[model samples]
Structure formats: C-alpha cells, structure tokens
Target chain A: MAEPLFDRLALIGIGLIGSSLAQVARREGLVREIAISTRSEKTLERARELGLGDVYTLDPAEAVADADLVVLCIPVGACEATMQTIADSLKPGAILTDVGSVKMSVIDQIAPHVPDTVHFIPGHPIAGTEHSGPDAGFPDLFQNRWCILTPDKSTSRDAIDRLTAFWRGCGSDVDTMEPGRHDLVLAITSHLPQLISYNIVGTADDLETVTKSEVIKYSAGGFRDFTRLAASDPTMWRDVCLHNKDAILEMLARFSEDLSAMQRAIRWGDAGALFDLFSRTRSIRKSIIEAGQETPAPDFGRPHKKGRD
Target chain B: MAEPLFDRLALIGIGLIGSSLAQVARREGLVREIAISTRSEKTLERARELGLGDVYTLDPAEAVADADLVVLCIPVGACEATMQTIADSLKPGAILTDVGSVKMSVIDQIAPHVPDTVHFIPGHPIAGTEHSGPDAGFPDLFQNRWCILTPDKSTSRDAIDRLTAFWRGCGSDVDTMEPGRHDLVLAITSHLPQLISYNIVGTADDLETVTKSEVIKYSAGGFRDFTRLAASDPTMWRDVCLHNKDAILEMLARFSEDLSAMQRAIRWGDAGALFDLFSRTRSIRKSIIEAGQETPAPDFGRPHKKGRD
Candidate 1:
C-alpha cells in the first residue's frame, strides 16, 4: 500500500458518515492513526466496539489534539458548537473539514471559530443509505460516489489539493463549487426531495380514508420508493432544513407551483399535459443511468424473496 | 402439479404485466395453453419472438374466443375500446379480468360489455419496475407481491375464488377491496407520489441556477430516488391520470395542503415540526419491510463498482 496520507485523522461524530470514513481510511491505509469522538456516550462506545478507530474519546477537543486532519461529521446545526469546542485544540497546521449537506451554513457557522493557522475546507458527500448510526456504514460507501468540496478564498491551494487527493484516495470523484451554489443545487437534489418525501409519508400516515396497514401493504406501487428517502436520519434532515432554509423554501415553492399545474391537469383530465411532463421526466433517469450515476435495475434491483417461487 | 388451473388462458396486451404472466403461467403450469394479443403489431411480434405464449395474435377477439380465462393486460384507457371488440366473442362462463392501476375506472369501462354468463374481475398488482414492454419482464415480477382483486357484486363466488387461486399460483397474496376505496388508497400510496416525483424532476430540469450536469452528478443524495418512479411507463401513467381523475385530484389536493404546511414550517425554522415529521416517516418503511412488502436493503442493495474499495 501507499504511505499513509496523514499521521493522525480525527472524526468528531461517529455516525454513518464518520464510521464509513474510518472504515475506508483503515481499508485503504490512508491514515496511520484514527481518532473517533462523539457527543453521545453510546455512539462512542459503539465506535469503540466496532474498532472504527485506534483511539476513542468523548471530548471533541481531545480527539482533535495534534491530529493532522479533523472532520466534523455531525448534524449541520451542531457545526458551530463543535467548532467552538475544538477551536483551541485543533492542530496548528491541521486541515479542518465537515461532511454537512448545507455548505453555506456550515461555512457561516464554523468559519469564525477556525483558527487562522488551520485550514478549513467544507465538504458534502453525495452518498448514504436511509439507515444511520455507526453500524450502518461500510468501507465502500464512498466508492464511485461524488464528494463535493467547497473552499473559501483564504484556503490554501496546497491544502485544497491535499484534501482532494484524500477524498480521491477514499474512492470518491471530487468536485469544487461555490458554497452558496452548492447549497442551492443540493436544495433541489437532496433537501427538496427529502422534504417532499417526508411530507408525502406524513400525509399518507394521517389519512382517515386509508388505513396505515393498507398504505404499508401496497407501498410497492410507488409510495415505497419515497419512504426510503423519508426514512433518512431525522436529525440530519432537520438540520438540513433549518440550515438551508432559503434554498429549500425556493425549491419547494417552485415544486408546489408545478404540482398545482399537475393537479389541475388531473382535475381537468388533460392527457396531453400529463403525458408531456411524464414523458420528459422519463429521459432524465435514462441520462442518470447512462452517466453511471444510478443503477439500471428495476425497483433498485431488490432481490426476490427466497422459497416463494 | 395441481392439474393446471385452466385448460386455456388468453392474455391481451403483451407488455410487462402480460409477458410476466405468460412466463409465470408456463413456469408454474397454471394453465395448459397460453394465448397472447396486443394492439401494437410490433409488441405482438416481440412477444412472439420471446415465445411469451404458445399462441400470439393481433386480434383480441380471436385470442379470447375459446379461452376459459382471459386477462386484459392493456392500459385502462384502451379497456373500453378493446371490450367493445371482444364482448361478443368472449366465451360464455369465461372469467375475464384486468390488471390496471385504477380499479373503479377499469370496472366502469368493462362492466358494461361483460355478458351475464361471464365473470369480470379488475385487479391491480402492486408490483412493477420502471421498465416496460414485452422484453422487460420476468416470471418473478409478482413474487411475494400483493394482487388486489376488486370484483363486481354480481360476480359469482366460484369465479372470485378461482381467480384468487390463479393469482396465488402467480405467487401473489391476494386481497379484496371496494373499487372506490381501492382508488382512494392507491391515490395516496401510488398516484400522488408518482405525480410529485414527476413534478420534482421537472422542477430540477427547468432550473436556471443549477446545471443539469450537477443535478445528475449529485442525484444519489435523494433526487434519484424519485427518478425511478418518475421514469415509469409514461403512457400507462398518463392513462392512469385520466382514468382515476377524481381520486387522484383529491389525493393531490390533500398532499398539496400537507406540503404547504411543511413549507410553512421550513420557512419559520420549526425544527421540532420538521424533526417529528421526518422521524415519524422512518417507521413506515420498517413496517413495509416487516410486512414482507419491500426489500430491507439500503438503497435497494445497489452493488458497488468492481475492484474499487
């Protein structure tokens, strides 16, 4: 294997992203030492049990001390507080980054506490399952996935290139974009879809006409597809909604307008309008599959049940 | 093994559902003879090439002339026209049924043409992939899935029981529901989610701020989840919209109201509200999985690229 990229790597929240990072780092020999920390005692203990890192602690400051790289993998809303806790302890030349969905807010929250001597690069990886916590992660989570990095004007070229190399070493294709633009793009691609899914599931759950059991039984028709996104980690999604408020609201508004038009077409039995919109959306998934961004299997390649046929 | 349920079985519309039925009937020995027909000569030819049935024809009336069980696998929009052509030719006491997403609409279209001696049952199998056509099917498509049968009041017990057994032979757990109630339930569970997915994909595509390439690259975040449903057969979905107009509009209205309230919460930065809704939807997927209604794998168990991790 290649020489270790960093002497010490610190992950401050041992959740899905954090655990996956640790697994990938260990598998690829990217870091000589892995330091894991979490606010909750249970998570930290679970990380220790999983042997996700060489050293484990409850104090973010203790984990960051002398580490070459410190990544905050907690909810977006906690970035400011986490930054405040680790500010004094972060190694002088260490590179600080985050795995938050909302980039601009993460920048606004953590940029202030980051020491002048430290390099803070914000990042968001476009990969995950609906599952959460330490047990949900695996080494291959980043494989062929996109990891976007957003750096400020003050960030050094060497630091950015090094971190880019680190992400690439972890098996991610890396891209750089403006923080605000990143937030807006993800508002449509991530936040908006998750929010819509949550709302739809909530709607189905509260319906008086349809029983919850019925909803669950017949989900394969289409509703089950939305439920996976809806089932994502609540704390992370809530933080995403709160942090990227403006962009999410903008996308939701546009989405609402389009839905109203669709509702109108349905109400009026306008086959042409419905056909046109449905036809147009069909090609995008084809493009996504063609670009190798999505799987080509039907129903996400779900395996058939055993002993049933 | 069970003396084959029927001596002659005829299927109209040699698409995904039809091809799958043909394959399953052959695999399970559910019928001694299978006959297939479609409105499109191309599809009929393709079905013939695939050897989907023992006999393939361009005429619906000819297909059902001597069959004991004739399944209408065509779109709901064409049910009325096809019924008009085959009503006189359908053998007396032959059980006629359909596989349509909208139940009440199918019942309304075909009930008028059914003779008193014939039994017509409208079914909607809660199963499918994004792919369509004769080639896009497998015998296991309906395995461990629900096949809802909405039979008319006048239909005999022997007919419903036999059709239920037929679906069981096709590897489906059967359920009976009122046509209107089934329409409403599916409106929330299937129609609304698909419409919302279509609308969201459209909104992302029309964006001036976010490039399509970026959207495609970052789709795994959540948007791609909706694309699978959005990429479904357009003509079938379009016909569903037209046929189930009232129920679909009602569900869309309810969904819009809930979405508006969600937007309000996001605008006001209601963390508790967002968290509660996000958290609540998490269990629905769990229930679906427990009920043997969905796959338990995360992201539907998409496989990683070779030799990357």
Candidate 2:
C-alpha cells in the first residue's frame, strides 16, 4: 500500500468543507490521523459520531498541536479569531492553509498573526452545494473541481507543492493565482451569482402581486432554479459577502448598469439589441457546457449516480 | 377515444413548446389532424420528418386555412406579424389562442386582427426548459403544469371550455386569469428569473479578472445553475423582455433596490440582517419543494424520480 501523504492533519471548524475534506482525504489515504475542532460541542460530537476524524477537540490550539498540516475550515468572518487562537500552538514547519471563499480578506485577516516558521498558504476550494455542516458533505466533494491556491512571492515552493499534492490526492485540479485576482474572479463567478440569487428570492418574497403560494406553485418554470443557491447557509454566505465587499460591490455596479441598458431596450421595444445580447450570452453557456465545466441537463444529475466532484 | 377537440389544429411554430404541444395533442387524439408551420423551412421539414403533423407548411396563411383551432406558437415578437398573415385565412368560429409568454402584449397584437366570428383566448403554458427546437420537445412536457388562460369578457364560454379540455388532454391543470394579473405574476415568477439569469451570465462573460475558461471550469459551484436559464432561446427571451416591458422593468427595479440594501449590509458586515434575510428565503425554497414544484437540487438536469417531483 502507498504511504499516506501526511502523518497527522488538523481541521479547524468541522463544517461542510471540513467534513468533506476529512472524508475525501481518508478515502484517498491522504492522511493517517485527523483531528477535528469546533467551538460548539454539539458539532464536535456530531463530527465524531460521523467518524470524520480520529480525534475531536473543542480547542483549536490543541487540535493543531503535533499536526504536520492545519486547515482552517471555519467561515471567513471567523478566520481571524481562529488564527489568533491557534497561532501559539501551530507546530513549527507545518503547512497552514484554509478552504475559504474569499482569499484577499482571509490573507489580510490571518497572515498578520501567523508564526514565521509555519507556512501560511491561503486557498479557496471552488466547490460546494447549498447544504452546510458535517452532515452535508461527502467523500467526493472536491473531485474534478478546481482548488485555487493564492500564494505570495515569499512563499516556499515546497509548501506550495505539498499543499497542491494534498489537494490533488483529495481529487482537485490545482491553480495558483494572485490573492486580489482570485477575489475579483470569484466576485464575478461565485459571489455575484449568489448575491443575485439571494436578492431575487428576497424580492419575490416581498412582492404583493404574487402570493407566496403562487410563487411556490408556479416556480417550476424558472424561479425554482434560483432558490437552490438562495437556500445556501445564511451565516457562511453572510460572512462571504462581508469579507468580499469591494469586488462584489464593483460587480454589482456593472450588473446594474448592464441591466438598466436592457431595461431601456425593453421599454423602447428594441428587439434587435435585446436579441443580440441574449444570443451572445447563450454562446457562453454553450461554451461552459462544451468545456464540461457543467454537466448539461438530463445528464448532470443522472438518477442515483455517484458524485462527479 | 372521445371525439377530437377540433377537426384540425394548426401550430404555427414547431419549437420546444410547439412540438411538445403537437406530441401531446396527437398522443391523446385531441385533434383529427395537425398542421405544423414555422418561418424556418428546415424546422418545418424536421417537424415533418418527426411525424409531428399531418401537413407541414412554411406559410402561416396556408397552415391556418380550414383549421378549427389556430394556435400561434411562435415568439411573442412575431405574434403581430403572424396574426396579420393568417387573419384572412382563418376559418369562421375558429378558436384563436397562443402560447406566448407575455399575455397583455399578445392580446394587443392578435385581438385586433381576429374576426368577430372567431373566439380569441390568449394563453401561456407555465412549463418549459432552456432547450429549444422541435427535437428537444417531448409528449409529457406539460404534464402536471399549469396552463393559464387569459380570455376577455367577449370570449365565449364554449370556446374557453374547449381550450381548457384541450390543455387537460395535454396533461395540464388549467386556470383562468386576467391578462394584466397574468403578466405581473409571470414577471415575478418567470420573466424576472430569466432576465436576472441573462444579466448575471453577461456580467460573468464581461469580467476581466476571471478568464472565460476559469469561469466555465468553476461554474458548477454556483454559476452553472444560472446558465440553464441563460441558455434559453435568445429570440424567445428577447421578445419576453420587449413585450413584458412594464412588468420586467418593475421587477428589475425592485430586485436592484433589494440588492442595494444587501450591498449595504455586506459593506457594514451586518451578519444579523444578512442571516435573517438569507435564512427567511431558505423556507420559501422548502415550500416550493413541498409544493412539488421543484426537486431537491432544482437546477440539476436529471428527471426527478417518481414521488420526488
């Protein structure tokens, strides 16, 4: 049998991503010993019941002690506090990483307090569903999905390679990007889509003309599609929005500007302009499908099929 | 089998909705003969090849002649032109209905041309997917969906009943609604979702930091959900925006206003407000699932298992 990638790994905040990493890492023999930590005893107990880790603890510092790798799996808003709590106990030469969505903010928050001897390589795993918590994750959550690493010039090549190797072992294609660029790219691709979904659902909820029952009843047509993203964990997403403010706000501004132009074309009945823009966007979806980034309809969710990523 | 609903029924556009109607209508013996027509000669030929109808024609007038029911199955933008072309050829007392997304504009366009002898009842089958074309349709497309009728006071009860029975034969539950209310309801439920989807896809495509490949690759995380709606037929959605101007703009404005408030909350790191709104919207999705209007992963392309949908 092949040797495991790490002798011991510590995962702070055993939620969706944390539990998912534990499952996949164990399934792939990526680690021998796993330590799980969370502030809530209920979640810690739940993680232990699920057998997500070999050991579960309530202390982040205790979890990180004697570990070769430590991954912060908490919400972005909780990153700074978790870093402060664990900094004193992080083993020297251990590679520290995070499975956060917003890179720049995470780096800004956690980089200042980390000890120089430990490698602090920040990353965002571009994967997840609307579901949250330990129960929500599975062993194949990162398969075929991109896990981006945003490292600085001062970062050691050995640290990047070790982290990259770990993600690959757990079934992720790795891409290294600048922290700011990562934030911007994700602002458009992930953050904005979620914001739009949440906002639209909120708007529909507030409407007087359409009864909530009617919206629910008739949602199969199109509205149902948005609700899945809107149904994502509120606390986690709230932290994401607050953490990635600038880029999200910029994307929002651009979206509103484009939407106003579309509104004008609709008001004046400019079919040509509306048709042209709508057609152009259709091609992008085709590309996304052709590139196999998304499994297109009827195939993406084959009944009782195993997870792709 | 019961007597046919009509001696002949002409479908003047053989796309997803049109071909699906033809398939169900034929499957249930709802009409003695079906006349299929489209502006595109290739689509007409394809319909003929699929055995979708007894006669296929590229000419709208030729298709409508001698038919007891003439359904305009084309995009909303072409309704006026198709009505103008077929007005002189319509058989007396024929029931004139449409499957357009926008009701008020459709009534305005086609009602003026209908002769006093004919009964004009505009409608919209609240069902469809992003896929288009004749081959993309199926017989069960309308099964268990709502088919809304927007008939005015001048419409005869016999005509309404016949139309309702025809939709029932196509597997839809039928309901009657005022044209304006139908438009507003659809704006919130259907049009707004499509518009927001298109705008967000466009925003992602226009992003500089996120390369197209990166966006496509990471899309499954969240962005791919919107792509299905964004991939809808460009001509159809363009017409929806043009014809449903007031309602779409109203919904867009409301959506933007809510987005601004959300932006402010995120900027201020107001986790409580964000969590409240986000969590509240989550229950609506639950209601939609309970209502059986959606699957657990609604955007997933799989045909939901029996008892799940």
Give the candidate number with the greatest DockQ: 1
By lDDT, the best candidate is 1
Candidate 2: tens digits of C-alpha lDDT, residues B136-170: 88887787678999999878999999999999988
- lDDT at A113 for candidate 2? 93
* CA deviation > 4 Å runs, candidate 1: A305-309, B305-309
Each prediction's TM-score versus the true structure = 0.98, 0.93
Question: What digit string (tens of lDDT, one per residue) describes model 2 on residues A1-309?
Answer: 478888899999888899999998888889999999998989999998999999889999999998999999998989998899899999999999999999998999999998999999999888787888899878767777789999999999999999999998877789999999888888888888998888999999999878997788778768988888999898888888888889988998899888888888888888898888788787777787676566656324423221211
lDDT of 1 by residue, B1-26 (tens): 78899989999998899999999999
Here, model 2's chain A TM-score works out at: 0.96
How well does model 1 score by local distance difference test?
0.90
* C-alpha RMSD over true interface residues, model 2: 5.2
